[model samples]
Target: MSTEISPESAFPGPRRVFQKLNEKPLRDDLIFYFAIVAVASVLFMMLPLLTGETAEIDGLHLIWFLVAGTLIVLVQGLITGAVALLAVSLVEHFFLLFVDVHREFEQTMKSTVYALSPLILFSWAVLLKIPFAGLLFLAWFCLSTFFGVRIFHEKSKDRAVFVALATGVVLAFYLHRAVGI
Candidate 1:
C-alpha cells in the first residue's frame, strides 16, 4: 500500500486542524463553525466577570447579572459571528477575483472559519489584562488564515499573504471597536 497520509490522518496541530477542516464536508464544517463561535462567545461573556466589571454588585444581583449577561452575550456573539463570517467570505472572494483565482464562496467561508480556531480557542488571554495579548492572538489568527488561504485556495504565497493581511486588519479594527480594546 502507498504511504501517503491523508489530512484526516495527519498528526494533531494547527496545520493538521486547518487541513482536516478544509477537507470536511460543508455540513460538518458548519457544525464546527457554530461550536467554535458558541465557545468563543461564552469566553467573551466571562470577560466582564474576570475583569471584575460586576464586582460592585452584591450576591443576588451578581448572580442575576451573570445569568442574564451570559444569555445576551451568547446570542449576540453568535449572530455577530455569523454575519461577520458571511461578510468576510464575500470580501475574500472579491479579493480573489482581482487575482484571477476563482473559488467557491463556501471554500472561502471554510478557510475563514477554520482559521479562526486560534483566536476563538485562546482569545481569553485578553481578559487576563496582559500586555500585547490581543496583538499576539491577532497575529496567530492572521498566520493561520494565511496558511488556510494558501492551502485551501491553492494561492501563491504572495497572494495568500496579501489577503490574510488585508482581512486581518479589518478584523483587528472590528475587534478594537467592538471590545473597546
Candidate 2:
C-alpha cells in the first residue's frame, strides 16, 4: 500500500475538512479548540470597532480602549461559546435519541463544532456592516449542520433539516443574547 498522502487528503477543502473532522474520533487538542474560539472572539470584537461610532480619543487612550475591549470581548466570547456548545450539543443529543439516531454525545458535540465552522471562520464578513451579512453566515451554519448531521448521524434528510433548524435556533438565541442584536 502507498504510504503517500494525496494533497486533497492532507489538506482537504472546507466541506471535506468538515466531513473528515466529524467522521474522526473526538479531538483531544484543547489548543485547537481554544484557537477557534480565540479567532471567533477576535472577529466578534472587531465588529463593533469596524461598524460602530467611537468617541474622539487620542493615541494612548485609543490603544488602551482597544486593548481593554478586546480582552473583555475575548473572555466573554470564550465563556459564552463554551457554554453554548455544551448546551446545544446536549439538546441535540437528546433530540437524536427521540428520533432514534443512537449517537454518542461526543459525536454530537463534534458534529456541532464542525457544523459551526462556517460561522466561526467567516465571521469577519460581519465587520463589513453589510445588511443581512449575519443572516448569510447563519444560513451557512445551517447548511453545514444539515450535511453534518446527515453524515455523522446517518440521519434522513428530513431529520437532518430538523436538526439543522433546531441548531440554528439555539445558536441565534445565544447570539441575540450575547451580541444584543
Candidate with top TM-score is: 1
Q: TM-score for each prediction?
A: 0.76, 0.70
Q: Listing every candidate in turn, what is its Cα RMSD in Å to the true structure after a full C-alpha superposition? A: 4.3, 4.6
Poorly placed runs, candidate 2 (over 4 Å): 1-19, 28-33, 48-52, 124-129, 169-181
CA lDDT, candidate 2, residue 28:
48
Which number leads on lDDT?
Answer: 1
Separate clash counts for every candidate: 0, 0
Off by over 4 Å in 1: 1-16, 51-64, 173-181
- Which 10 consecutive positions of candidate 1 have the poorest summed lDDT? 172-181
How many clashes does the backbone of model 1 have?
Answer: 0
**Model 2 per-residue lDDT at 96:** 77
lDDT of 2 by residue, 72-155 (tens): 989987887788678767877766776788777777877777666556666666655556768777777788777777878879
